[model samples]
Target chain A: MDQREQGKAIVITSGKGGVGKTTTTANLGTALALLGKKICLIDADIGLRNLDVVMGLENRIVYDLIDVVEEQCRLEQALIKDKRNENLVLLPAAQTRDKDAVSEEQMKELILKLKERMDYILVDSPAGIEQGFRNAIAGADKAIIVTTPEVSAVRDADRIIGMVEAEGVNDPDLIINRIRQDMVDRGDMMNIEDMIEILAIDILGVVPEDEGIVVSTNKGEPIVLSNNHKAGEAFNNIARRLEGEDVPLMDLNNSDSILAKFKKFVGLS
Target chain B: MSAVIKTKIEEQGVILSFNPDYCWEEITSALAEHLQEGAQFYQGSKLYFDLAFKDWRAEELQNLINLIESNILPETDFYFMNQSSGVERDNKATPKEQPFSPRSAQENKYTKTAGNDTKLIQRTLRSGQSIEHMANLVLLGDVNPGAEIKAGGDIIVFGKLMGLVHAGATGDKGAAITALQLAPTQIRIASVISRSPDEDKSKELRPERAYIKNNRIVVEEVNL
Candidate 1:
């Protein structure tokens, strides 16, 4: 493989909170690892660490990103190997500290060192347009903006996109999460077209509202590992798209039935 | 050569002057025609006229000013100056700074009855950022997907309105939202909340207006 292709650092962020930025980062990191690629996920939300717990590696973190940046520990010592996959590692944030503990220069240096060993470096950015968000996106080669179908979420996503663009990150892709199909059919919620038209950015994927995602996160297991969930399959498709595959979108309109599969195959509603 | 028209803008008003080498009559006629062609663009804007190095008499200068003023759209300010009259080099007369405030005196005239009734927001309300204004609110740019706005009166977006908007947020019931593209994620007028339909099958994409009618948010096409 080309040395430049060894690692591609991507930051998953949203301008608004509670829109699945960490969840998307964790799932995408795991999904990419399952494809036999060596992946390292960095939880850049320093003060409020959650990616490690979502990835089920919180208990195993004896050293963290701050320790490595502060030179209290070696980079290898801070890398926590996942129980499910040895190839997947996590650099958890320090929960006891704040975002100020890590500077933008330190994040860039850490990602540079990880680039030498990993195939992908996924950073989970904290919500808001503050220093924490800037720190998370400092060393990113690309950014993934996660949002929901709701109006508030889309508005924040647009503002974040504008900010990122102003910082010279152009063409950031979008991921619309927590879309409820029934509500969409009933005209109670904004649909995918409404989001795409307003945001006007390239869409990475759309994840449906899956209860399995909530349960899996509670158990410290990524939903992507559960093949039974529609959200899981949607995330897997997103991973494939990231890997440059042209897989068609999952038929979310007619989910959970054989007829849905038939509809997906026929490319019809 | 391009027309060399001189304008001296000041705090009091704009003053107009023309170069003696240029055709004053032709240029003045051209300016009047241009103003007529694009009245809305010049309306309410301030300009100063400078007649430097021109030998035109005071009566001629007055006639030019009157013609320009007559051609100008409503609310526009025009000031005239002539070098012959020694008003061009008056150091004490300073040009007014371009008004940076969103609301101007003329705009205020339209909104005075609603005095101090309009709210001005200067920052981009990011996702999770929300603002509730007791009166009419105007945004300079987009209201992103995760952001929200609630105003007691009309809401106008100089840019896109992509987030949730609640006009007449306190149940005034007659509030409306107008935008370059009114594809809001969620819109509410009084007690009614509605979302824009999916764009895949919906073809009627144009500038639109949303208002409350019979306790429901109704969207209608708007012609610019």
Candidate 2:
């Protein structure tokens, strides 16, 4: 059962900040783990780390990624086991150290070590195409770009796609997060087609604007662990697709019920 | 004797070549007058005093430093270089330095030739990237939003232009900006600045050119 060479490292990046890169990483890691795959989520945001908190493993962190890279602790000591999933773990970024503390070579070596133990290593990259960004994509086999349905977000995604390709991480997938159905119905927002036209990348999944995401995030639980929310279902399908499953795209238009609309209006879902 | 103090603007800093015959009094007065006349050009710029074998007393050097410090911004730094024989510093002139200073007699001689030069970039300019040139600029790709292009002369973009652009940056009123799709965030030509309209622009995309006319910037379609 040790198919160590089959381990795939995917870096999740978005050039702009506040576009749900961390949230997507947390949900995707959680979803993949629920599928019985060995998963290690690495929060590479360094000083502004959030993946640990998003995964509800912040309190369990004793040794972080920096500790392992700097040889202060063994790799296993830095891996925080998820409370719910036995197959899932997290390597939290150093809250005190900045991105410069970890070099690209160090990141490459660390990912190589993790690949032997984990089936999938999901790297949550920091925003901006700087040294931190370069380090995040250095050892990744593929990239998943997260973007919103706004012009600014799409523009930034285009830039990030170009940079990702230039780094030789070919054929990055796109995940359009936080899509509002009502806005699209009113033609007030850019639909999925317009974003695909601009970014020109294969769509992985689309998560509709879900209030459940905020609740789950505040609760330090990934939305994918919940079965009721549409976003959770969407993330589950995304995980299935990553595992080479042919899951159909979630139909956001037909799923908009009157009760869901009322819940959105009252800010209570 | 009235000795000459030649001022040269270089990449390193502004070099004031002090003639050996000039006394401390002559150097101080001439430098003060030059500073007063072109205060804007010297603001926040480093200044170097090239004393051509001219040695100064300790008190005289202190007075000169005080005078220049009081006149310019606090951020501006000044250095002294004695190019006497056996000195450690290299005496060779900078090969790529462009001597330019606004509102001075040297402006007409340097800026005109610099403005005539053109640069061609054959790739897309992405966000957080900026391109600034002393002359005309021709880009053969898209200029994404959050990127910026500034030129002393004209700017020509072969593809979509959605970034902030400034043509005729050095006050060349005749300079223009032409693009395949001219939907930039902001446009500046010479002293005039304009932005895209706040209303919805769902109209057809067309090639357009922007130029300054009657002291205002105007955009017009490029007839195919």
Candidate 3:
């Protein structure tokens, strides 16, 4: 196995549901693939399976994670190639089975086998800190916690961080998704600082609330693939950061005058 | 906090134990300092504490156990040899009385009382979760947010509070939250809410008490 092939497995998780864990995973995996890394995205949500659909690779699934774990299919038979990128792969979760069908050790072994060929293994964890969450984090060397700007989401993220820490994974990075900066400025929503004060972890990225993301999800394509979407650019920046590049965060202020947008359009950015 | 001398013997792989009353803070600090001074030399060394007259609660004992356990390599096993017969008896007695004696009467009185004294919790607070129970809201363990606990009367962490806390939520302000970790996300006593300063970050994680002062809550280092 190449050194990069023995890659770190990172589980993208949020303790609360509806906080965009699958969206972040698909976007990050796609963005990383665009950067020329061999990436495998595993949907560990089991019965609630959606990452495949979000990544636009649902129809290609024949064998799945449960199949590989149960010895009904080989590991390579389960990987669905991303239509947009040859280097990107998806290990779709079985939609018909419950989370208990796969054990933690089996999950670890599956990742270890994949590690021998992939540059990154991104496990999309299920919502709630239960058996599914534990299985997703079983083999991950790192974790990215996603939360919204609401008190409930932030609170759940905090709990997930503590659990991850107790599991001996220190310094899991934070990603505050769907942030409405306007609400933050108006004090109607919790600010990034409020979250950082409570989470006390290094932030990896911040994704603004973008209608384009919802539209793209509806169409079964992650917004990260589109160059025009601001959220796409943000995910790209996250990918660069993951590659150890110090990319400055995009200023999400909507007050950017027409002149600024015109300038950005002309590559004056 | 009194100072006590602790010695690590290479031959017996034992940490010479001193009485907890002999100044726990000093003794622990001194031992830590000594270990730091000879860190390279002491690396990979096993520690067996000679707990003779030392009396420690389960948490305190667990903390010490963790300290010794972490000091050694993962592959190496370590043990604390309790030399005193009374120490075991003391340890057993503490847990039985510690959780019950202080609150049994108060719990009875509160349950019997009604109305203005009632507390209500709307949702499950996860770990890291904290709530200022302005009255008497009881929760099953699920507060997951590095939470805070502030009650005007009594504060209980059904789950875990890895954040900040203040009991006496309404400023009966004389309230306290009892949890595995006294660390809270924020603490409120009556009209005042204060948080633990970032400066106290260290390995000395313990259950603590917080109270209100000139419109602010102050946390004091304490033992349960």
For each candidate, report what fraction of the true interface contacts it reproduces: 0.00, 0.00, 0.00
For residues A105-215, write the lDDT of model 2, one tens digit per residue. Answer: 999999998888888999999999998899899899999999999999999999999999999999999999999878998999999989999888899988888899999
Tens digits of per-residue lDDT, candidate 3, A151-179, equal 99999999999999998777999988998
TM-score of each: 0.53, 0.53, 0.53
Calculate DockQ per candidate and list them: 0.01, 0.01, 0.01
- C-alpha local distance difference test of each model: 0.75, 0.79, 0.70
Task: List the per-model TM-score of the A chain.
Answer: 0.95, 0.94, 0.94
* Superposed model 1: Cα runs more than 4 Å off: A1-4, A255-259, A262-269, B1-224
Deviation from native of the Cα of residue B55 in model 3, angstroms: 61
TM-score of 1: 0.53
Q: How does candidate 3 fare on TM-score?
A: 0.53
Count clashing residue pairs per candidate: 24, 0, 31
Q: Per-residue lDDT for A89-182 in model 1, tens only? A: 9998876567887888889889988988898999999999998999898888888999999899999999999988887777899999999878
- Supply the TM-score for candidate 2: 0.53
lDDT of 3 by residue, B1-224 (tens): 21265543322232556646656776667666655554433333333456666555888878776555445433232445555452222222343432212243234334322445445565656432445432455554544433334444656555445444445432244445555455553555544555444333454546555555565665566555
